[model samples]
Target: MNRFKAGEHEGVTWVRGIAGWSNFSIKVFLYLVDGVLIDTGPVKLSGILVPFLEQQKIETVLLTHYHEDHSGNAPYLAGREIPVYINAISLERCRVKTRLPWYRKVFWGNREAFSPYPLDEKLTTDSLTFKPVSTPGHVFDHRSFYLPDKGFFFTGDLFVTTHPQMVLNTESTPRMIEDLKTVLRYDFSTVFCGHAGIIHRGREVLQKKLDYLEDIQGKVLHLHNRGLSVSQITRKLFPGRLHLEYLSCREWSAEHMVRSLLTGKATAENPRPRT
Candidate 1:
């Protein structure tokens, strides 16, 4: 019943962060290194993971990002006093949005309940040997962690694996795209995204995500140039996707995908949904 399972890879145990009681939703992480627990999940499902942490005698818990699902279980993780770490940006965003990071709300349609917590440690360059790679666009504070020895990149939301396409969400930002391009040059083999899946062969998935992103952005520009309104573009080209509820949320996930095709914005400007 508990989807919280750990996998051993190159002598390191990687915990698959599963959100939601039923279907897989978000991915939180727990990395143990020589007795230090890197991070904890943000929800109660993370409760299932506690046994694993206790068994390992983990003494520290670092946060990859401060999103709700990722850090929701902090209260539960209090026993270990697993000192959490985040950049100033992550700290501020957590206070404002009341969750992990911003784009996550955009991508998943403002999912999960909120729980705000202050970061116990602000990881500065001197404190962490491995620098946090600033990868925004996804969210203003989104960062990718790099381990020089293992060639690991803990990418929170930078590398997503949502099937044919990640239902275009208003959360998509120019900053996120720019960060992705910057990460491509790094020498990392795996990326652990904040949602759905993990990419072991980072290069292939990275290339596809980039190419697909660029292609769709261009498609959006072309359709906008054709004098198509947001609603017209969705009706004519993305009819099947129009029914997705995530698009109808306050962030207008998929709706933004179409609106991007027009004004590069998702607003009520779209003519009322066709009857």
Candidate 2:
């Protein structure tokens, strides 16, 4: 099934997309401010997304990253001659189609290829000045946008939760910690998270996430120094696999979360049976 919801706050328009069944559904949010759209919701919900886009007077589109869930609708907007922007690192990669595993294709759907302009250091409109912030770690090409004057921060996938139990094999928890800290340095009151939706007292929420990850990092490293293997340390801290981990065929797992903190590298391994 597909789902869509629309709302507004602080003059920013947000649309949510849900793809899946009941509580198992995956969701992503698309935000629009000052005629600029941030992060296109996944392609799976394009039925609703398309009509919504048709009604908006979008002046520019800004992608927070190249992830399928975030960049899914770029092609739709680009075909209409609307200016789309992304980080330079993914500017060329997005020009070609994105390949995904079976599960990802099921959840987010496949993203079509489209050429996008590289993001400028800062973006401005008649009403607001937007600053493009380099906030990697969720993915190397990830970024966040900030509205200094309005105290609004648009965090892509950077702060999905204060404590994430499962992460993609490609993600780095340690690097993500740094990314969280990097953004916390800026003054912001409200956060527009891609998955969690609007967050007030945003700085406090981000700080908690940073603190949680840092504590996890300390625990993972302490256990590693005691001669614990990655698997051993993983079990010690984030034992067992989540349903999503099994669904993704181990592409997303607690073990990857531990490994990222220990060495910032991900290794391919089968999920150990839960004890």
Candidate 3:
């Protein structure tokens, strides 16, 4: 339930998320420029977020994506029709995709307490403007909020503050590469992620992640071509002989990537995890 206010920006002030939850905690940013609260953390911890928010002069909520750990407090926020803004695709995922067993498990109880969250307007702002980079892969609707003026990026779950993995349960390895490439073009000073810890040398780390992922792809392809099952290769490439523990931490779902390798479609939906 810790809250840390960031250095002032002319237009926006950031309320950064604290560190603690394995993947449960993140440094969520409340862009205080327009008084918009970006993402609301877990619902069960309403006392943690809502009361903290009550002390602020907030205008609305602009959810980055819909992971329950990230969006857990939506119900409590829905006490009134607070104008919550999010990507359209993310909104759909919240409503439909999250109901699947995989999604349900990831979100805990957000799907069950389903109430119509009041969303005022979809983000039609220019992608380049506001530094809002559409960095999906962790989830299809994921968006990375960038403050170009402030030289910061709320990377969400896109970038792992911890060690990177090729576990294959998560969907974004390839997409992460793309995101890294695109976001790297920006001169961001710091990158805040959902878990692990805040990263200062984010640009360099992002390049390293990209290099690692590219290398993993080649290895995964070679192993797959050699008739190794996805799990076999996943283990070998990840937690197996590599000592790359937590390569598939909640921040990244390596299992999904492996399934995509196995069946050519690595979509995770609350079904019994393949491995």
Q: Local distance difference test, per candidate? A: 0.54, 0.85, 0.58
Comparing 2 with 3 on TM-score, the higher-scoring candidate is 2
Residue 196, candidate 2: C-alpha displacement in angstroms: 0.4
Tens digits of per-residue lDDT for model 1 on 210-269? 776676667766776898776675566545642334533434344455554344333432
Candidate 3 segments whose C-alpha is farther than 4 A from its true place: 1-34, 93-108, 111-129, 166-170, 239-253, 261-265, 269-275
Badly placed stretches (over 4 Å) of model 1 are 21-29, 34-38, 92-128, 162-170, 196-198, 242-252, 258-275
Candidate 2 local lDDT, 11-81, one digit each (tens):
99999888784358767889999899998888888998989889998999999988889988899999999
Ranking by TM-score: 2, 1, 3
TM per prediction? 0.72, 0.94, 0.71
Model 2 steric clash pairs:
none
Candidate 1 vs 3: which has more TM-score: 1
lDDT of 3 at 101: 35
Backbone collision count in every prediction? 12, 0, 21
Residue 159 lDDT (model 2): 92
Model 3 RMSD, rounded to 1 decimal: 5.7
Candidate 2 minimal-lDDT segment of 10 residues: 266-275
